[model samples]
Target: MAEVATGTTMAERRASVDLTDRRALLACQPDDPAVLAEAHRLKETALLDFGVRDSVVTSWLYAKCHHHIPTTAVETAAVVATGDGGCLLLYNPQFFVDIGLAGVRFVLFHEARHLMHRHLYVEPELRADPVFHLAAEVSINHVAMVRLASGGLPTRAVPDGTGGTVREPVGVDPHEIHRRYAEDLSGQGRKPLSYQDFVDTDLVVYRELKRMHTPLVLPIGLCIHADHVGGDIGELPTDGETVGRIVGEVLAEAIRAALRGNRIARDEVLNLVDRSEGGGDRLTRMWGTLGAVALRGETPRTRRVQWWKRWLADTLASKLREGERLVYPKKQGAVLLALGHDPMLSRRGRERTKVVLVALDTSGSMSNEVVDWITSLVGQTDGVESHWLSFDGVVMPFVPGERVYGGGGTNFQNVVDYAEGRLTIDGEPFEVQPDAVIMVTDGYAPRVSPAQPDRWIWLITDGGDDWPEHHNPPMACHRVITGER
Candidate 1:
């Protein structure tokens, strides 16, 4: 349900998307093995080239998606960000051959940048205005041209099967789109932005477009999911929020990777971080949640916990689905309908609401930094109901910033009982089982089996014993390393 640059009716946009869906991606090679092999090779080379050029952003974005679906549904290539913090990069093999290497690189970079800009993470306000979408398309294309350093459109043919070639123009060129805007504004006796100034920031493009009587609308074929009218009509974009989170996580990951000797990843991440909202406030918040301590530029000696938080975040995302949901009725519904989404409203709630149990064993050994970190982490996380337990010999529920009583011998059993619906909070006994149990403690206490062992995720303090690791049945466990920086 996208607004066609051709000014087609909403009905027409929906119909076109329906026609495209019939061309769903082929999971594996069909009759010709040679074509599939060549396609794979091209994709590999593109990935390599992209990785070499901008390692951090490209690497993280590409890894977040699975790109094996060969589709005729999309004219060029498209990405469907899945509900599970993953993405589907569906493309027509012929399109790859069509655009050639330069085009492919541009498209891949375009898609990743869209993710970076939280493009598909469309909000109601942004979607209600077509000018915003147009601005985004222009900005995305402009950024691609600048970064890839492509002088002109790369519509050169790349060889396909049987000596045939696919030579197709890729996305809407920012220059051409800007030229249209410039001409329209000039006719209206209004000054237009230069190409450089026009495409400077994501919001700037929209603000400038609003200054014009009629902004240029590039056709749907040009970009990925640029719509108040979604590329997938009728369905609400449920996974968009999750995709947004994943995008941040990956960007932060890339930045950390860049810091740790990934020169290519570093350059791209710095560029992305620089251009982000609030002058990289979004990245700062993301890294803080991830407990990515290296962003503090801590001394080289104590930065031993680089990859642990990434691993922890990924693990927790899978198991910690909460019961409640948020609905976007007006704009999100309109946007999804514009895309012709199947279910109309993207309904995304589980049967039961899950409670998160954060049992902090506040023994003398536990650091305030770790406690403060966990408090911030839990405070920022939404959607799930969190129960904080500070325990030593006895289990007791406490609120954030509430001083916890401890110094007694550690008692892991009491924490387990409190989490397993057998304990009380504020004099009220728990009635339901928790969905996930996170224990922050020094592994000095005896281990007891919970009703669900897999739901138990234990974080042991530095140099502390990890009893769960040596238990009869192992569970999810990680070391919470403290630094002196």
Candidate 2:
């Protein structure tokens, strides 16, 4: 086991605190300075222990989060994303002192896991369900138990029948939840999943729970994370978009570290990606775009798409959807017109055929594989009219697999000029106004400004300069790796 430094200072910690809200939260009842200091020390010690022994992912996540001890505001420990693009861990000082080191570690690990869970499962309807919330608790706590090797959950001292006190498990027990599931499913004549299969993934756990005939009553003393308040959990204070960005960045860095030969990080990162499969289209695209290749190594070629292909498709979809505004549904509008009345049915945006211009650099640098893939993608996509061009020192209109000879110097300006209607191809004016202009090129060309840079997307090849990313008005640029040797 190796020790990892958090790299945060006292000044940075203080700066992360929201001063105005801190003042208002603490106005009711503030903890003694000494008690708060002791709690902070205990939390730091637990985090250090996790870095060395428990989990690198947890250590890395909390290292980036700001810790706040608002005694009265948080009943227990909770991890929240702040509006300022940072995460905060709120804990009660007295609660920490009572729980001691082991309890503190368990609670902190639980909260960190919640942040990860929220990031992976972002559907509004799913989060609103109480069964799903309970399933999340069961899944997370099971992982925490196995990782920490704790015999049972964190406990609190309660009065025994004959003696002073006894420490009992204080959180939802996965085994107990499983027993209830088994009993409920049996009554419905449905086969229940085994404990191992039940907690396989977050989505699996949720789906299985939804099959129950009798809803399991939520256990008393369940952690605040599972308690539904106004159809939402308590720990999620920040918006979904912000939380996704922050967590995605953290996971991306963790994967990079894993690739750099951190064994603990590798295991944790891979497990997360494996478990998050089939959660949603957005989650799948996110993991694919992030680094599923490097994390899981070679994926078998089947119906599954390569990471770069998914990334390109997602990017193109966003580009094509630009300037869309919601309008009345056509069916309703037609009925209203026939009945001679005004239709106020606003459903979705009108479907307009989008034009996409893809110019491939033909200066002995273009890959036929990439060209073929692009052709298939654009050709299969409905409601899109695609124009293919091959450009070097000059521009030539050609379809995929049609070789046009051009060994002259690379000039990006020629492609821009042609697309913007300044240059003509074969004595015909470029008439179509493209919604997205995709340029596939090598680095050996001078950069030129396009009229609508916002609609421009640059895909730089291997060993190519991606100057479009750093231009005055930076355009959308991505590295194009064919992964062919």
Candidate 3:
């Protein structure tokens, strides 16, 4: 988990609250400072306990979000993505104090799952449906219950017919909802899904709910997301792109950590990626960008080109074509200008062969198939001068099929030295400056910064460190999934 930011005092948080609207001000009353302080303390404790006992992914994600205690601006708890590339966790202070620590954990987990669900199912139409909203709530709560091992939903204090208050479950019950589905489906002479299959995926839940003729199970208590209560409380409207980027970065870091031997993180991330498949286009694209190869491994032979391969091809194309100049078509420009339109310009690159350096770390095990794949990819690209080097402690140029031998200590600095023309192999100088440098290594050596970090792309094999991604002035780094070899 990332370092937690310093939190604001109760007074500072209350002062920042927006109370401009008469109705909103009336709807949201400030709680006592002592109550607010207690609420904040409870929330902090809940988050800490979550890190120790619950999902590491959630722990990492919530650490990156900004927590706001805005009195009753939010009825319960909500996580909203700020348009400026950040996430905000808003909560009602009084509600927190009332629900206590266990309740706080449940709510926090529920809200985090909501954010993940939003990122996965980004289609506007899908979000606008009320049935989908209920289905999402049901699915999230069920998962939260099973994962947290709370044995039951969190309860909120509610006023009884008498003077005293009693606690009631705060969200829809999955079992109750499932029961309703079963009854409704039986009446229609159709079979209902088992609990496991019903909650298989968010889309599956929605589809099953759509089949029910009975009314959906609405929450008896607060559900800020499904109730749509947080949008009007001065919270920044959720930006899909910002949410995707934030979640993507978190998941990517989690995957890298898993590769570094965090068993809990690996299990959680792999399960998430596995369940999230076929969710939606945005989810699929985001997983692809994060390299599902490390999580899902290689699919069947039918899935010829993996997501990382496509990503590398696109990234290389962009990198190698960096210096291309845009030119305004003179004839078309004049014609468009006369018709009151902006002319479309075309990009053209200088007619020169692009130089590319490929370094393979011989100390680490790399399959011949992978080497052959890289060879074909680089070889087939038009007008690219490719240099292949097999290195462990020393740099040595070799063809794809040539026998390369090295078992010495790994040193990445040696590759940098040779690439920058500062070191010679067998008294032969490397004169050409590479347009891009592709380093395929296990990444167990000392880190080195190249002359041009932008031109360097690091591909760490399975069980390898991806430290370059978090290096000072980070470079393009990815994990290459090597299965069985």
Candidate 4:
């Protein structure tokens, strides 16, 4: 901040600002006492003949209260005067954040640049000329930021609305950024610009922003609420922390995906070694491994299988003929043979197989894309009963007649309870057993387990966190990824 690089003196720079020209350019001058005072203070900072104030620059700022801009603020918009009539500056950070900083700055600069060039006074060049002017404004701001970041501001020419001599940032393309921003805006049902054009350039900004710890929580919250309850679920609560909580839930789900292996990692038992209460006995909680798996989204491929041991366990129903009593397939071959046979239809007095309880994750992260697919997996056969349980933080029995909805938290244990209940000998004595308990989830489920159901198939989309990894599941557990068999 001390050394004036490029050997440029402040006076020389101030001289180029042309306060008189700027005041003359703007038809109006600041009238508000507070703003006027600030402007005067800024101008007076030019002390010892070493001046400051970069080109009577017009800036934009916005004020919001009760979801509406104050009348006083709008009235203040009429009062910008930089001595010389230059550009009228409006400060609107909130608007820019919503519309994208680069875009908003472009519009502000475009209008300011117009005033600087006296385009406003001339007969309106087409009613829509303002649009082009706005674009130019965006271009100017973009060029300025890039120049500043690259430490080449003084030498670089700003991009004009039309092509100009402005040098694109070194190793930081902007086309893609612009295009993506445009597309994102458009996808929200707004006017869109070409996103692919400067995608490379935009990534630089995105990376930098990410490095700076920019808050992505709000946008993620907006997306979740939009996808879950509907985007128009009233204005998002002003409390950003609540929004962050919502995002945390979503991000947690994404984390689950990274921990487990891809779909092929399915149909295996989780290793609940860590969660076991010493002595390597039964696990105190299955969620420890599941949580670890969910958190291991970026785990290396070689180590994924090492996290758990998978075995195709005994099948639910053994080969039963008419009057042939249930002979639990204790051997792996019997289990495999039973699995090979269709459990739905009865052949010559064969009893239909008990229903398999299918649990589905309905977290906000489990977008409809995954839900619709899981729904399709529900068996429609009259003999083979299938049940669906959709859950987030908690679980509930998905009654056959009810439509699947409401996703936020995920608790796989409740789903297991429902499946176990059906498998019990009777819903009363709990002796019946299910053929298999299939669970499809993003895998951030809470840690809990009911009585072990027969073959447990965990078809995870995102890797699951909190899946037990101590004692391996007694049955075969396969983790099929989305769109996989």
TM-score, predicted candidate 2 vs. hidden true structure? 0.43
Which structure among the candidates has the greatest lDDT? 3
TM-score, one value per model: 0.45, 0.43, 0.43, 0.26
Per-residue lDDT for 340-421 in model 1, tens only?
5432344466555556788888783666677777666656666567888888888888887788887678788877777765
Backbone clash tally (model 2): 0
**Candidate 2 deviation (Cα RMSD):** 23.1
Task: Please report the TM-score between candidate 4 and the true structure.
Answer: 0.26
The candidates, ranked best first by lDDT, are: 3, 2, 1, 4
lDDT at 122 for candidate 4?
33
Locate the minimum summed-lDDT window of 10 residues in model 3.
Answer: 1-10
What's the residue-level lDDT of 86 in candidate 4? 27
lDDT of 2 by residue, 156-210 (tens): 7767888789876666788888887888899989899999999998778888877
Over 4 Å off, model 3: 1-29, 53-58, 61-64, 119-121, 215-221, 226-485
Once fitted onto the true fold, the runs of candidate 1 whose alpha carbons sit more than 4 angstroms away are: 1-6, 9-11, 14-24, 27-33, 128-130, 156-168, 226-235, 238-485
Candidate order by TM-score, decreasing, is: 1, 2, 3, 4
lDDT tens string, model 3, 263-326? 8888988899778878987776655556555455644332344544655675688778745668
